[model samples]
Target chain A: MADANAETDLKQTPLHDLHVELGARMVPFAGYSMPVQYKAGIMAEHLHTRSKAGLFDVSHMGQAFLIGPDHETTARALEALTPSSFVELGLGRQRYSVLLNEEGGIIDDLMVTRPVSEEDDGKLMLVVNAARKDIDYAHFRDRLPENVSLQVVEDRALIAVQGPEAVAAVAAHAPKAAELAFMSAASMEFDGIDCHIARAGYTGEDGVEMSVPAGAAEAVARALLADDRVQPIGLGARDSLRLEAGLCLYGHDIDETTSPVEGAITFCMQKRRREEGGFPGDERIQAELKNGPGRVRVGLRLDGKAPAREGAEIALPDGPVIGTVTSGGFAPTVGAPIAMGYLPVEYAGTGTALELIVRGRRLPATVADMPFVPNRYYRKPKS
Target chain B: MTTYYSKDHEWISVEGDIATIGITSYAQEQLGDVVYVELPEAGRNLSQGDEAAVVESVKAASEVYAPIDGEVVEANGVLADEPAKVNADPEGGAWFLKMKVGNSGQLSDLMDQAAYKAYVETL
Candidate 1:
């Protein structure tokens, strides 16, 4: 719900008018007036993306590039800030990493990509959460080495076409983009429009995200929507899809207070980086990697239909409160209520009995393995 | 018998001193899918505008307020198992509760069918 102040203060995306034309219900999100759901509704939209294809306007996310003399300088400068291995990041490849604060808390999780072509040699493209972009930019400007600099791209609109039929839909315009392997990216043209297309997305599905010029965003979106298989999806479906995928949302599941290890996203950190330890809050993160954090984030599947939303107290069966739900809702694909929260490392095991105090009553719950719904991301086959 | 509407999107039907309450079709449409519903127990007394029931959709939870002063006579237990009924037949089998009206005069504060329909347009 957008309050009176929200309506006046929020910004609009490039496709704002198009969304309004499609009968979308706009809501204030991340300082932008974005669509929460279209005429098809959240449930129908979620199922449509799973069974078919859904297009989303992710332009609200921040896009930038780290400019340096070469990849080595840029990657090392970034490596000093994050715990991920970026020096060896293959060209055309992307990796998920988090920005750590001084104390090792996850400031934000971001996608780091190295463009494929020689013309784009010394640059590593970055896409960060909209809410934390300002903070991330400020930190990079303050901490980055003199040789490397951050250039935020403000003239581009990011669009994602996701789900089972996503590739087929996107291939109709950009055939070269469809050929790239998952987690890889390529700069291609869509009917003469130059864009950076990444074979990646937030939904647990095979898809691609196109960074297009803001002026031509509507044209690109309209061309994609012309395909019968693709429908416009809003933030509501996007959140549900990512939740079912066991992906963490920035402000909710992971925030400035939780480390990547405590957030249960250790995949972003490699073995070499862990042992060498040069990033911010390395001491705390390294300690957690070995001893394990006191509280670890885990998935919680409710025993009944009642959805336990964020802020619900999670406790032992008839026991004291142990943690709180950070992200939760009725998972459309799972056809059940699901949630994620932080719990003691001992109680984070799968199938551990748990209780969620939603409203006033304590409902039965259990520690379930994340990715409540299996991800169908495209995996490149071997020769 | 007459149907009255509250600004909170509840529909109330009164025949003599007995009143039946449920969310309107418009409310159901706004709420998308109704996943769960919490209804007040029978014999519970409610004042006008008091929170009587809770309705949860996939994304949010909304409280359904009592339309008028009343004592609960019965709750629709069918919704306990089939919450989708609220989206399918919001003002019918999905009724939240039936109550013995304590003061019928309070009904005047609510809008009639035609007035409520026009009022929703302004929103």
Candidate 2:
């Protein structure tokens, strides 16, 4: 992808050649040559994923295992560095967490999963943002005790099959993956290929993310593509899909200077961690949770077709600027322009009227509840 | 009647004192899947190189500048409902507007089809 010869320094995913063969328009992303869109273009691909299933190559993200002598040792050590309830994390269960700096700003958002069986040797698996992977590994290396070590799993490719039909499509090859509940993980064979499948994804859909060995990645991808429901989706639709789902794209919506509470993702910070207050930035995070953050992320619905892209100024009606847009775009699901930005608590209300300076014109907008489209994540019924 | 192209990828077809304006086929291909088009009002006057219209794709919004100074005579209303026409027929049905040519002298600066084809290859 990305012309392959555009820049010799850029890395390529295992599915890179497959994307090019599928007529994907590749672009530079997170230092890798990734597909931005296919021949169907962004709009159709986005709508198709919401209706059926879309397979995305996410191998650029960092995958690693924290190995220790036993479960308690690794879980406790991980909990010490992150604001997550990892100690109570049930076997086979996974929880989303943020790595924070000493001052409480987020270093990165990641997923930590406790292995389902003892054969994994008390390894806690982590999947971090592609751009923040290197920095995160360094951070973990510098802090872990001698007994605990980080094992980077670079010889693997990750793919996400998402949408309403994702479960049925994946269940065809890895039947056990269908039985796993939301936020659960299991090791299974996909068409005889070994893989680690997780019943989770970023698209706000009922989906599974599979991690397969590098050599077998292409075969796995081809098998998935053979299904009519699963088409190769590119990053263009991925951004819009996640935006409609109100999910944050790490570096765009949150960064080193943003707190988990300010980012409106305190739900990821479990209650036990909230009270125990042992992780980095607990002092600042706790204070913010108690006193409320200075600025909070909120959604905006624009009045017209002209989208208020990122970096647009958030202002009151003919008044002074109060915040800046972090992510904004033409949300195909909403059929209008939608934006997410951090605004003062007073202006974060759903009915608050605001203005966005887009393309040198003041566009009228109003604060609205997020997930411009409702989240369709599937949850099993309690017996 | 003769057609001229601008380096910015706009095309103008001149017939007497009236000229029709639209983006070139190459421009439409580069923009890809036009979802919306914003054209100037019929009576508005424009100078050569003025930002006359805006075309929006799924990923970005691009300006369509005036190729020659003129007063807008009419805008293609059909494009408002069917913006994809710009991609399907950039030069004919998707013309953005018709203008009363303000100065014929400005036409000398534009490239003919042969020259534009050569210029595009260099890009």
Candidate 3:
């Protein structure tokens, strides 16, 4: 159902030809023609990512650099728009944050990585969701002061090599990448091509994301794929991987009407931001943090193999609807159907019984703890 | 025995009053890697165009419609454990159900093998 013929106006990534050559099933996603899966199929791709390294073409996502006089100036300007402690973010570190509307709802969630060079102190590199990039760019362009500027880097392609073997496999091409600890980044050369590698990924595995010039993207991908442990993965596995990791997908899990507190992303709001309450929607966020959100995001495990897809109603036995599933599917890693959804805080506790109205059938389900598969991020021991 | 295909990619093989039904091979390829299946219960009466079964892949779920009015005779029990057979051989071992035809005339409206093959090319 997903492989509808792409509309003529849909955009294509730099690796479009390469994907087609590899027998990828192309589908229209977020206005771009992307590979949903290759010849190995989604099941095999998902399992391969869990056992080895899987390369993902995330080039459709927006990449940009925020430039200002110094790190303090840029960080302060950004902090005013989002609930994050950017000023305290150390060089080479990456932090996840959400752009919020005045009503305190999420505009989009993004990654902000500080380049690890003294000269690049004033520049903050950002990676925003593909579908929200244009809107996000327009929003930031309208808000930042005259001294600060946003530079959209459309000439670059982003690729993620994820799984347990990702670190060592990537290090084979650029040994400097091995030095990056989790949530960190640095500039490195891949096969003589200048690239930026980050020690982070959306999947629950330890991995590196590389930013390379558009022309060199395919070559970089080939260089990484040449490794025995690496295979080209597609968007199908990407969604399942992130879901099993308990991470939110922008439009599905968190959207403009969903607040961070209710979305279970309160971690993005650090202690300082929570106390000061200066960012957009801070008043309501602070209240929810202290009094507890009216509704909370929780994970669900279905009683059977029938997947409770997005928009399915969650209810008590013969009772009124209490919640709705936001994201759900058969988690290949868990080998069962899993879901994440919003429920009244009362029914959010793990092991709480519930039923999902899937196509008129009242399927039994239970609230469960997330990261259905434990995160396997590699963190270096403190010296 | 004569095989017929519907515009919606369903296929039927009729012998006597009983007709075997399943999705076409093209349909299975589009759905990709079937993970779960929900079949209409045996003995349920279904009208033409009514949903007869549901096939779910990793990304999406599709409803398989009844190509003709019929009374369900049996649903494939094998699919409960081996749904991927739908991908392996959609018109063979992956047949979804069998039914006693209620309207024999409806068979004339469906496409034969040659017609279905040409129809698939346009898709």
Candidate 4:
């Protein structure tokens, strides 16, 4: 990646120097100077993360803590905004939820974690997208209960270590981290500093997310990357990695105009939230749940070598435009062109034939199931 | 045989009135992990600097230009399925097209290997 230092003055992450030392091609991403890939390149990094482990410096994301009087008070305050059962959430567990507008469109997707101990009552942690964090925090501040306090933890940096070998790689450095299951989080010690370690990730792989103090972030990232299995990945690989795993990016796949139900993210809303009907756009979501959404997100496998990219028109048998691709790429592991887009419910089934209009040529395509690469979540054992 | 390159990083191997075309190593390095290639059909006449092919990577799409006026005699069908070959051997097996040159004088306008390397360094 070419560096355009003259173009925009962007903020640098704690691992900025480390990335440069590792021969990373730095690029401007979400207002941060981040690595898009190392000398090994994006494809190699994408595949390496699939087979081994990849470390990502996502400290650009915003972190905060919401405190009230008790768990019931905190859960009620959070549930008023997001469509998740924060009350039923076990201590130390995290939930994937969305911030929605009044009309039900997604504002942003965020992670909410409840600390393991009752000692930290009415306190919940939130991690939001870097680009939308300011607006998200302001929105929360305006809507949260008067008794609830919102504190932005700017002194922390978030690091994600993802892939099959992630657990082993991280456990090697922090032994107690091995006991944390998927979506569970706890305050822990690393490199002589107290930090929050969560069993979560975006790549659909088994991984851990460490929220370390800003000053210690560089040391923590270095210690993780010092392992043979861990390599620093950039945004180029990050986009492709998430696409291959069928994860929806906030601005691209699910945006202000797209609802969680239509985006196939209704799973984020628990049954209690669905029936209680209190979160924003509850009517639209309930209607969608009962009758199904008008259009739905689905994956596509192009028939030929042509990659059907975002904004490419998807046409029907008669050559009429039916939908548009939101995310498309050549999956490094799949070894072919894969894409995800929104199509009418009638045309969302697997094997449904379609065509992608690419530069005036009609390339044949078909609907496929999501998570083109199967997810390997480390959930607790079913009772 | 002599090799010359265009500013867009396409290289042409010239021998008599025939030229073989492929992207330079610098071009491939910038594109990263080529997933698909859209080469012009054989028998299609092209002008100098025409947009003759499309190369897609996981991150973005790029256009490959024709370095000289010519008629395509052959297009690399191998790249249709194995585009990574471009990354593995950009100068060797991953050549995009072969053309019958219509104007020999166009070769003087292109850069040689040394000139191309220096030009790339400025980028």
**Model 3, span A343-378: residue lDDT tens:** 999999999999999999999999999889999998
Worst 10 residues of 1 chain A by lDDT: A1-10
Candidate 3's displacement at residue A187, Å, is: 0.4
Write one digit per residue (lDDT tens) for candidate 2, span A186-266. 999999999999999988888989999989999988998999999888898899899888988788789989999999999
Which regions in candidate 4 have their CA more than 4 angstroms from the true location?
A: A1-8, A381-383, B103-106
lDDT of model 4 at position A265: 90
Better of 3 and 4 by DockQ: 4
TM-score values for chain B across all models: 0.98, 0.98, 0.98, 0.97
**lDDT for each candidate structure:** 0.93, 0.90, 0.93, 0.89
Of 3 and 4, the candidate ahead on TM-score is 3
Which parts of model 3 have CA positions greater than 4 angstroms off? A1-6
RMSD of 1: 1.4
In model 2, which runs have C-alpha deviations exceeding 4 angstroms?
Answer: A1-6, B41-48, B69-81, B102-106, B114-123
The sequence of per-residue lDDT tens digits that candidate 4 reaches over residues A183-261 is 9998878756788899999998999999998889888988888899998888888888899888999888999888888
User: Which should have the higher lDDT, number 2 or number 3?
Assistant: 3
* TM-score of chain A taken by itself, candidate 4: 0.96
Per-prediction DockQ, in order?
Answer: 0.62, 0.38, 0.54, 0.62
User: By lDDT, who's the top model here?
Assistant: 1
| Share of reference contacts found in each model | 0.61, 0.21, 0.54, 0.75
> Model 1 over residues A297-322: C-alpha lDDT tens digits?
99999999899999999999999999
